[model samples]
Every structure is written in C-alpha cells, then in structure tokens.
Target: MQTEKVIEHIVGWLKDYATNAGVNGFVIGISGGIDSAVTSTLCAKTGLDLLCIEMPIHQAASHVTRAQEHISFLKSNFSNVTDIRVDLTPVFEEFKTEVSLDGNQATVDMALANTRARLRMTTLYYYAGLKGLLVAGTGNKVEDFGVGFYTKYGDGGVDLSPIADLMKSEVYELGQFLNVPNSIMKAAPSDGLFGDSRSDEDQIGASYPELEWAMKVIEEGKTISDFEGRKREVLKIYNRYNNSNKHKMDPIPICEIPSDLK
Candidate 1:
C-alpha cells in the first residue's frame, strides 16, 4: 500500500466523519511522543479545530520541554489550536485519599498513574463537549492491536482513532513525511506518569518493530494451526488484557427486571 495515499485517506476519513457526526473538531492529548505528535499533525492537515492538552503530573523537566516543542510545532502548522497545560499533582493525591486504598508504594504509584491518565481524558472531553469535537486517539496499531499498551478507560476511551491502523515504526515514517521534529520522534515514548525509568515497550517486553509483523498477520482474517511458542506468548499478553479489562472493552449491560415488557 502507498503510504501517501493511506495518509490522505485517513485524513479524509477524519474530516468526513466529523462532518457526518456534526462535530466541528478533534481533541488529542499531545504527550510529545511520536504517536501523539503524528496524530496531531495529521488532524491539523484536515483543517479541523484541534485542541492539544498538555497535562503533566510529576513528570520530568525534559517531558515538559518536549511537550512545548510539540505545541510550538502544532501552532506553526494548525490554524485552530488551543494548548492547555494543567498540572495534576493535587488532583491525583486528593483522588487517592478519597478512594482509601491502603496499599504499598507500587500500588500507590499505579493508582496515581491511572489517575493522571483518567484526569487528562476527562479534561479533553470537557473541551470536546464545548467545541463539538471528537477525541482522536493517539494509540498506534502495535499498541492497540498487538499488545494493550494503553491505560484502561484513559487513553483507550476515545470516539475515533486515525493512527490505530499504523504500526509504531510506520508512525515514525509518516511523522518524517509530516516534518515532525527529529528530537520528538527519537525521544523515548513514555506515559509521563512514570518520571523516566519505565516505558511502553520496556514494560511490554517487545519492541514495536519486533512485534508489528506478527500483529498484522494474526489480526487479519486468516488462521494458523501451529502457533506454539512465540505466537502463544503474544496470545498470552493479549488474553491478559482482554480478560482483565473486559468492562473497558465492552459496552454497559442493561439489567433485566423480573417482569419486563417485551
């Protein structure tokens, strides 16, 4: 498939969907990661209202710097752009105490991480509400389809995704085409919930380039009978998330009454 044609098709899909849904814009969390930067740039090319939320919490100085760079890049390109920087330390701690979870430091940290992610999602949706915007997810094909590298109910909860079909490596290729800054593209992809030590690939135990090929074939409408070792491992990871977060992956169930009208 031609990459340029695919890019144009994806952008066109976003615009046509926005018009059909009666939404005027697309809101994306600009985390300074390649995925978000690429997504924001592509959305901008569509000439839609794009809001980039810079929500940082207990993150390192480098993350904030890169985020600003992304904002500057977006402003230079996109016509309608709003950059909102909301520090989430206070809100995170308050939510932790409110929940009353008495766990160790690791559990506490995970809670804080999930809190920050959900908080950002909430903030984006608020502006989305005001502007009749749809949240454009930043997850790539590898992150979304291969392994579940996103936070449950956080980044995964979005109206639509433009980059969900592209792998991480392919995303960088497209970013190069869009003239995304080399620094931003080469920087480590982080959740920024962790200061610097952890990363999506490191946590998942497989790089995007290593996993994308297998991901594409398995997700296609084809079957294999002899998937014993590596394929088994992939299924294990996929199954873990699929079982763990079934609620997040599915719609709410309607409760049935004892006597209901049919």
Candidate 2:
C-alpha cells in the first residue's frame, strides 16, 4: 500500500472536507491508541486548528501516560496542535448514582463501560460546537466495519472519519510514518473503557492480526467450513461481533410512511 501516498491522500481529504464544510478544524479525543495517534497526526498535518482532548474516566495509568505523551509529541511538532485534559471521573460517578444498576453484573458493567465512551464523545462534541470544529473520528477499518467494536452514538458518532477505511495494520504503518510516540506504538491496543488493564484482544478474544486475516478471508467469500482449529475459533469470534453489532455499522432504522397514507 503506497503508505506515503495514502497519508497524503487522507491529509488532503481532511483539509478539503473541512474547507467545504466551513469548519475551522477538528477536535478529537486522544486515547493513546494507534488509531487516534495516527488520525490526530493527519489532522495536524493539514495546518488547521487541531484540539486533542484527554477525557479520562477511571482510566488506566498507562493509557493516560501514553495519551499525554502523544499530545506532547504533537504539540512539539505542530504549531496548530493544542491539548486539554478533562477528568470525568466525578461526572461518571454522579451519573451512576442517578441510573438504575439492577441487572446482571456483566451486563451492568458493559453498559457502564459504554457510558464512559459516550461521556467522552459528549465532551468532544461540546468543544467542537463551541469552537466551530468538526469532531474527527479515530476508528479504523477493523473496528469500524469488520468487528463493530466501538460504542454506537459514542465513539462511533463523528463528523468525519479520516482513518475508517484503513485497516488496523495500515493505521500502524501510518503511525510509524507520522512518528507517534514509541510508548503508544508499543502499548497493547485497548478501548480503555473498562478502566482496567484488559487489552482489546482480551475483550475480543482475537488479536488484530488474527481479526484482520479473518476479515480478509470472509470478504473473499470464505466460510467457517473452510478452516479448522484456531483459525475456526478466530473466524467465529469475528462473525459473532460482526453480526451482533450490525446495528452500529448500519444506518439507523427509519420507518417509511406510505405515500397514499400521507
């Protein structure tokens, strides 16, 4: 994949989109993950106002550190880049107090984890609205399309997705080219929603490379009967996520009224 050309294309695309939309620039949540690091860098390269926000809710120390490191790296390299840290721990706690927690422990925990992402999304959009900036998404191909791993109307809600077409491996290639912090490049990929040390692999039960391969084979018209052993297991994991989270991948359902009735 012409990595340099790809980067140039994304940068040019972003700049053109923002200019056409009449927005000053972009505002994105920095999660210290490869996707965010690469996407934010591409935004900065456009020479437009780029706001990197850190919204942490019981976030792991490593995630926080890596996020800050990446923000610092961006600020040093790009004059148009700026950052802010918003600690939402108290806000999250208050929200839990007002909501019903009656459910299966696992289900309740999952809902709250998604809440963290929604809160961060709200924060990003709040600033974007105030500053006339578009909310830039950091999701990649695997998470956004293949597995539907992100929260709907949360991290999935964005004005633009600069890297949604790039696979996870391709995003990493862009990260390396953009000179993202070494700590971020080396850290295990995580959603950081659980506020623990669990990586995305732990939650998905398949590493990105495995999922990427599964996505590729499935796209090529392969089926479960064609593989065995661990290959089958990975395919199963990918299919489960892709099926269950189809709602996130598809457009919201709208009831169409009959023209005669109208």
The deviation in Å at residue 144 for candidate 2 is: 0.6
Please give, for residues 38-154, the per-residue lDDT of candidate 1 as tens digits.
898888888988888888777788778887998898898777887777777777767767886777987877777777888888988988998899999999876776566777778
| Model 2 score (lDDT) | 0.95
Q: For candidate 1, what is the TM-score?
A: 0.85
- How many clashes show up per model? 0, 0
Off by over 4 Å in 2: none
At residue 85, candidate 1 shows an lDDT of: 79
Which candidate leads the pack in lDDT? 2
Worst 10 residues of 1 by lDDT: 217-226
Q: For residues 90-156, what per-residue lDDT tens digits would candidate 2 score against the true structure?
A: 9999999999999799999999999999999999999999999999999999999999999998999
- Which pairs, if any, clash in model 1? none
